[model samples]
Target: MFKLPELDYEYGALSPAISADIMQLHHSKHHQTYVDKLNAALEKYPDLQNQPIEDLLQTLDELPEDIRTAVRNNGGGHYNHSLFWKVMTPGGSQPTTELLGKINQEYGDLETFKSNFTQAALGVFGSGWVWLLPDMSITTTPNQDSPISEGVVPLLGLDVWEHAYYLDYKNVRPDYIKAWWGVVNWSKVSELAQKS
Candidate 1:
């Protein structure tokens, strides 16, 4: 069965950018619902339960039709939220040399990359995610869709879902996006990028 992963820091650690209330609700409530639903969805397919959530998402078409959608939504939620937690830290960290070099090569400079990424996040029509792909490309996926579904690994992801920022930034998504950068765990993102 799937389970919500424990955060590396306290719920209030990401405050100012992401509030303690938002963190508690997002992780313990929202993310936990995803885990519960995903596990419930797989109850009839015990064999599939042992498979990694990433594998399930990557091979959704191969799953039985009866439970495919459930797994896709809930499983994608599981994977996305899991990465979301890890990609952020209390005070944040700088990108490693390799990751910074690639970001510069692909986007000309870090500021340009941030601008592009922020724009992409804003462009998302509704609840979705903006991801930095392994190739250093920026992409957006609607709803719970993950980059793995498109055959690419995500190095970094920003959740633009209303639930992610409504309490803190209200209707100003741009403000939330800007504050979010302050908490990005670049070290973890760089590790993921280098591994890819």
Candidate 2:
């Protein structure tokens, strides 16, 4: 059975950008639901339990039809949130020199990249995510969808679902996105980018 990963830091660590209350709910309550549901779905096909969430998501169409959607949504949720927690820090840091060079090569500069990425985040119509792909491309995934399903992995992703920011920033998703930048874990992004 799949399980919810423990956070590397305490819930309150991301305060100011993401509140303790919001983190608690988003992690313990929201993420836990995804883990539970994914586990239940895998129970129907015990052999599939051995595969990682990423594998389950990337091969959704190949899964048994009866449990395909459950695995897609909940398994995607598990993978996304797991990466989400790791790609954030209490006080954000600048991208690694290598990542910075790559950002410059693609977007011309970091500020421009942030502006473009922010616009993409704001453009998401409803519950979804804005991702920075390994190629330095910006993209969005609706609902519990993941970039891995398309054969590309996200280096960094911003969760735009209301459950992610509602308690703190309310209806203003832009504010949440703005605040989110302050806690971004660029080193993790750099590592992921290197692997990508």
Residue 157 CA error for candidate 2 (Å)? 0.5
Question: What tens-digit string does per-residue lDDT give for candidate 1 at 49-134?
Answer: 99988899999999999989988898998999999999999898999988999999999999999999999999999899999999
Residue-by-residue lDDT tens digits, candidate 2, 1-196: 8888999899999999999999999999999999999999888798999997778888899999999999888988999999999999989877999999999999999999999999999999989999999888999999989999988889999999999999998899989999999999999999999999
Q: What is the TM-score of each candidate against the true structure?
A: 0.98, 0.98
Model 1, C-alpha of 125: deviation from truth (Å): 0.5
Model 2 — which ten-residue stretch has the worst lDDT? 50-59
Model 2 residue 194 distance off true place after TM-score fit, in angstroms:
0.8
* Candidate 1: clashing pairs of residues: none
After superposition, the stretches of candidate 1 with alpha carbons farther than 4 Å from their true spots are none
Candidate number of the best lDDT: 1
The RMSD of every model to the true structure, in order and in angstroms, is 0.7, 0.7
Off by over 4 Å in 2: none
lDDT of each: 0.93, 0.92
